[model samples]
Target chain A: MTGMVAAFTATILAAGSTTLLLAVASLVVATILGMGAAFAKLSGNRLLRTIASAYTFVVRGIPDLVVMLLIYYSLPALLNQWIDAMGIDARVEFPPIVAGIATLGLIFGAYMTETFKTALQNIPKGQIEAAIAYGLTRRRMFVCIILPQLIRLALPGFTNNWLVLAKATALVSLIGLQDVMFRAKGAAEATGMPFTFYLIAAGFYLFVTVFSLILLALLARRFEIGLRELAP
Target chain B: MNWDVIAENLPLYAEGAKLTLLLAVVSLALSFVLAVPLAFLRNGRVPAVRYAVLGYTLVFRGTPLLVQLFLVYFGLAQFELIRASVFWPWLSSPMVCVLLTFVLNTTAYSTEIFAGGLRHIPVGEIEAARAYGMSRRAQAFRILIPGMLTRSLPLYGNEMIMMLHATALASTVTLLETTGVARRITLNYYIQFEPYVTAAAIYLTLTFVLVSGFQLIQRRWAGYLESRIG
Candidate 1:
């Protein structure tokens, strides 16, 4: 029993850490892209709005699995074209990690664009006007006022997005990334007890999700403290 | 760019699309049937049953559907006990496995949606129904279910569309659905872009219909809920 427990713990740590790292990096990439796309979506320029809208619509409409597979299969060819265009002998391999991060980031960024856009809509228009009236520059207004409020308004949705993105990291295994699910699959096949190993994989996911929920709740509570005292 | 290639593959793609629609609609219908009862059970007085349903939903929702599909398809198939069991006949078909996974996954999601709607139902409504001498079962079916359905219809529609997108994962289990057929086309011609682009176009079209359909349902339910208030 002790030996089995040790083996399971080792497997969970081995897989869990890598998957969590990839997921966090992907979340960072997705957050940056999503902010840009959300801004473009809210821009007055019709062309920019249309382009951003199209990206979000198309990406969200398709399955993440399909997007991952397409990217995993096609990114090499796309990169090869760039390498060929540069007229260099240098060849770079797109590892499963790259594919996983890029694809997951790309898809989640589309979803986040909409989430952030909705949050942006909720901010009163007068706040921005008041900032401008106070002689604040556009950058200053965004940094000092708009950005903080936007982040707070979007935190709940963003937390949900982060949860979804974490679960999405499991799809990385489908593309041959040696994440927790991938390692679990290998162990399951080796051990011939598919249920046991898969249950362990599920347990790992539950642990991450529960831990994340607690952290999110704490962050949300911290954000609410002063606001609640001010409320009715 | 090549209309000719798309035209030639039209019928094949349509067949795949038809299969995709069939798989999604059938599974969604099954999911709704399963979810309504499960959602009610989750809210019932029985602690053990409620917790059991909660566990089932969590396990199904927390894990990736791809893993669950694989476990169902290959895991069960590999087992001699399952193979010898009478259930093997239903389990043998790829379509069956896909449908089972789709139904299970969507049921977990929809039960939560339904449960949310159920919670939002005012206690006053139940008290009013009780005052009218409605039986418990009558209150559940007539008042509670209708209120839940009206409140949940829009969210449930979104879940259905999400399930439609999820059906593409069925391709991973070797079911030759739309995406799978698209992959086969790409493999056969060594032309990757056109087939995938075509498949994506088809998916977007389906999503368009899904969104429109959900909007209509939302409008209908809005009228019903408003009428009840009136």
Candidate 2:
């Protein structure tokens, strides 16, 4: 009995770690894509703005699982067809993790774009003008002026997005990723105690959520050091 | 593009779309009913009641809906007591289980949104009601509830859209919702892109409709605030 308990614990912990890693990796991808899309939406080019708007609209409209399944099953099929047409002696494959991350990153990237856009707009326009007037290089201006304020302004929305994204990692298990949900299902089947195993999985997610809330709250405070809340 | 497979499966997709809408609408309506009382309790003066509601929201919102669904569906069957109970038949049905999970999940979120709306009600409005010698019940019925609903319309609309998207999860538990039909087509035809794309298109249209519907409703319900600002 002890041995069985130990094995179950080990499996769940490892799977939990995988879920965390997938979430972090997908968040990094989402942040980058979101930043780029935000700039595109804000850019003067009409085509860029339209494309960015369409990206967010379509992504936000569809279900995450549907998108994930579409990418997971269709991308490789499309690639292999292209390979066959080219007479290449190779096949392309997408591991579940890769597909999971790509789908999530792409979906949440749309959300992050909205958050970043609002944050960017909230920054005083004069700050940018002042930076340009002072002859600061564009890169330096962004780094020294825009970036800090953007982080502070965007943190609340970022925290909300991150929490939602972390919870969304559970969907990856449906595609055969060995995340906590998948492992919990496995354990449930093996032990014939689905309730216990699933409850444990819920506990793991709850812990992550509570921990994140605390961590992000601290980060928000850290970013707010030089600012004061206006009286309501 | 497997046009033949898609054409043959059109009826199935339509049926699935109806089921999807059913699940989403039923769950959203039920959650709205459940959320109203819970939201009030969350803002109630009693510490224990407020905390209890808080605890419920925390657990439901913190954990993924899939886990909750699995726990209710597969986990409950593990118990002999539940199996022997009269409720077992209802609980055993996949549709019931999915609906139950969705209602619980959406209620948690909607509770918070509604509570926030209640909190944001201008203090002056409440004071005015009090000064007018309105009874507590009258103030609640005429002032508080309407204000919260109107103030929370936009957020509630968002929750409605989310519930629609979440109905796709019903496919996982053997319900032939839109995504379920898509999955079935993929299995049957050994073709992936067309079925899922069809489902996506259907979902996108639903989302667009919901957004436009909410915009009209918002203009109707919250237009006074807008006119004031303008």
Candidate 3:
């Protein structure tokens, strides 16, 4: 009995680590996609703006699970068709983990685009004008002026997105990613203690949430050091 | 690509959509009913009562809804006592379990949203009611609740849409909601794209309808508040 309990504990912990890795990797992908889309939407070009708008609209409209399932089951087939059309003899493999991350990244990218666009817009226009007046290049101006304020402005929304994304990692288990949820389901079946195993799974998620909340709070305070609110 | 498969499955999709709507609407209605009183408790004077409500919201909001669903659906049946209990019949049904989980999950979030709305009510408004010699019950029912609910409309609309999307999770437990129907179609046909894409489209339409409906409601109900600002 002790041996069986130990095995379950070990497997769940290992699976929890995988969940964390998936969430972080997807967050990175989402941040990059979101940043590009935000810039595209904010650009002067009408076509870019329209395309970006459509991307966010469509992606945000559908549920994340459906999107994940659609991508997981379809992408490989679609890729194979393209490969066949090209007369390539090689087959590309698409793993469930990759599908999970990509779909999550794509779906959350829409949300992050909105968050980033708002953050970018909230940057005082005069600061950019002043940076140009001071002869700073666009790159330097963004790094020195926009990035800091963007971090400050976007952190709250970013934290919210991160937390949601972390919880969303559980959905990847449905696509056979063998994350904590999958492990818990297995343990529950094996031990006939579904309540105990599922409770532990919830504990794993709650731990991540509470830990992230504390860390993000510290980060927020760090970024907010020089900031002061205007009197209401 | 398989137009034939999609066309043949249209009725199944419609039936699934109906179930999806039922799940979303019932759970949202139930959550609203539960959340109103809990929101009031959250805002009430006692620290213990407030903290109790906060803890419920924190746990529900912190964990994934999938976990909560599993805890109720699969986990609850693990106990011999529950299985032997009078409620086992209702608890054994996937539909009941899903609805119960969704209501609990949504009620937690809605309570917080409504509580925030309550806190945001201008203190002066409450004071004015008091100064007018309104009874406590009158002040609560006539003034406070309406003001909080109106202020909560936009956020609550968001929660409604979220609840709608969340019905997709019901598929995991063998409920034939929209996503479940899509999954079944895929299993039968061995074609992935058509059924899932159809599901996505259905969800998109529902989301659009909900958004427009909320906009109309917001225009009529919350219009005055925006007008004051402008």
TM for every model, in the order presented, reads 0.89, 0.97, 0.96
DockQ of each: 0.48, 0.87, 0.85
Give the range of the ten consecutive residues with the poorest summed lDDT in model 3 chain B: B189-198
Greater-DockQ candidate between 1 and 2: 2
RMSD of each candidate? Answer: 3.3, 1.6, 1.7
lDDT of 1 at B153: 83
- DockQ, structure candidate 3: 0.85
Residue by residue across B78-100, what tens digits does model 3's lDDT show? Answer: 89999999999999999999999
| Residue-wise C-alpha lDDT for candidate 1, range B1-230, written one tens digit per residue | 34577679889899889988999999999888999999898898999999999898877777777777777776676578999999999998888988998898899989988988898899999999999999999999988998888888877887887888888888877877789888888788766556777788888899898998778877776576767667
True contacts kept of 3: 0.86
Give the per-residue lDDT of model 2 (tens digit) for B1-230: 57788888899999999999999999999999999878899999999999999999999999998999999989999999999999999999999999999999999999999999999899999999999999999999999999999889988998898899999999989999999999998998898778888999999999999999999999998887778767
Candidates ranked by DockQ, best first? 2, 3, 1
Q: How many backbone clashes does candidate 1 have?
A: 0
Report the C-alpha lDDT of model 1 over A1-232, residue by residue, as the tens digit: 5476458647755878889999999999899989999999999999999999989988888878778767877556556667878998776567999988898899989878988999899888999989999999999999987887787788888998887788889888887898888887887776676666676777788777778879999998887775688899
Question: lDDT of each prediction vs. the true structure?
Answer: 0.83, 0.93, 0.92
Give the TM-score of chain A, superposed on the true chain A, for all candidates in the order listed. Answer: 0.91, 0.94, 0.93
TM-score of chain B of each: 0.94, 0.97, 0.98
